[model samples]
Target: MRNLLIFCYFLLFFIGLSCKETKKEDINITTDDIEVSDNLQAVTKKSKSILFFGDSLTAGLGLDIEDAFPAIIQRKIDSLGLSYQVINAGLSGETTAGGKNRIDWVLKQDVDIFVLELGANDGLRGVPLSETRNNLQAIIDFVRQKNPEVKIILTGMQIPPNLGVEYTTEFKKIFPELAAKNKLELIPFLLENVAGIPDLNQADGIHPTKEGHKILAKNTWEVLKDVI
Candidate 1:
């Protein structure tokens, strides 16, 4: 009986040690995750903001988010060792009016640079030229109001004349006019070489493929390098 008791005690002690080791391992794994928070805070503190606010093109549409122009831009920025954080605020199918509506909320964060890429959907939907212009203007006003020092970049867009030639011509002029009036930088057209290019565009021909996004990043980086 004494021998039996001894064996039982030894077994219980070994089991207890095993349980404690397992608990300690779990704790170590949790600690490693917690350690990542320190790095996150450092990154946040060091990074400045470059906000891309626009529609589906900015959102990447059918492509993977990483294949999106904004992410490509992010990679470019990182490659250059720039400290700017590229925030992709693109909403699929958003119009200038919708952008205006959300401008205030979007501006809650500090924006060092703002890229406005809206109005394409409005043209496609045949929204009035005046309304689109007004909405875009309002978004610009709100952005400046939020941060007067923020440098704004306006991206021009052209639509098929589903509405009419007159409407199409007027829509094309809106971006340049706004850029001139606001003294903001302009991209001329967001989808320059990629647009209407069968190989560059996806099957739908609206969004760009991975190769196309590379061109987009190049287009943006051209103007972007000068600014930053």
Candidate 2:
């Protein structure tokens, strides 16, 4: 009887050790799972961001979201296996003043590349050249303040002859002037092949159609690809 009792005690001791080992294994598994989750979150947070900030031209007014140039750029980035995420902050009919007012809110997140495409609506509205320049400069300054390392791409815009030659010429010069002053990359013209072409533009003749967006994307990609 003494021998049996001793054997039972030994069995209980071994079982307890087995249970503790199993518990340790479970704890290790849980720790590994948590570590994996943390790694995934870190990767997501570290992905670079490219922000396309602009007006109706960038918004793709009459077309689908996928038809927009920003979306097209996203597709290109994805195809190249690039990790950069594109944020389209375009708003319809947004003037330089509107962009200036709204930029503070828009820049609440990280921005690696800032493609600025404003001042078109200002030109259309016949807003004073000085006011447009001031507002645009303010927006640029705000962006620089938000991210000093951000690569700025200023897109040039031109208005119809209704705005008069002096105003139109001055407006056209704004982008290059700002680009030179700020040492920013210039796209020269955003609507290069799309503007003035009836087939590329929508019925309003201001916004580009889906087919036109492809050309615009090409134009943007030419300069943007080099920077990225």
Candidate 1 to truth, TM: 0.83
Candidate 2 residue lDDT tens string, 145-167: 98899999999888887968998
Which consecutive 10 residues in model 2 have the weakest lDDT in total? 38-47
Q: Estimate each model's TM-score.
A: 0.83, 0.81
Over 4 Å off, model 1: 1-42
- lDDT, candidate 1, 1-228, per-residue tens: 999999999999999999999998887456667779855864685568899998888898888898999999988887778888888999999999899888888888778999999999999999989999999999988899888999999999998777889999999999999999999998998888888999998898788888998888788877877888
Candidate 1 RMSD to the correct structure: 5.8
Model 2 residue 35 CA deviation (Å) reads 25
Collision count for each candidate, in order:
0, 0
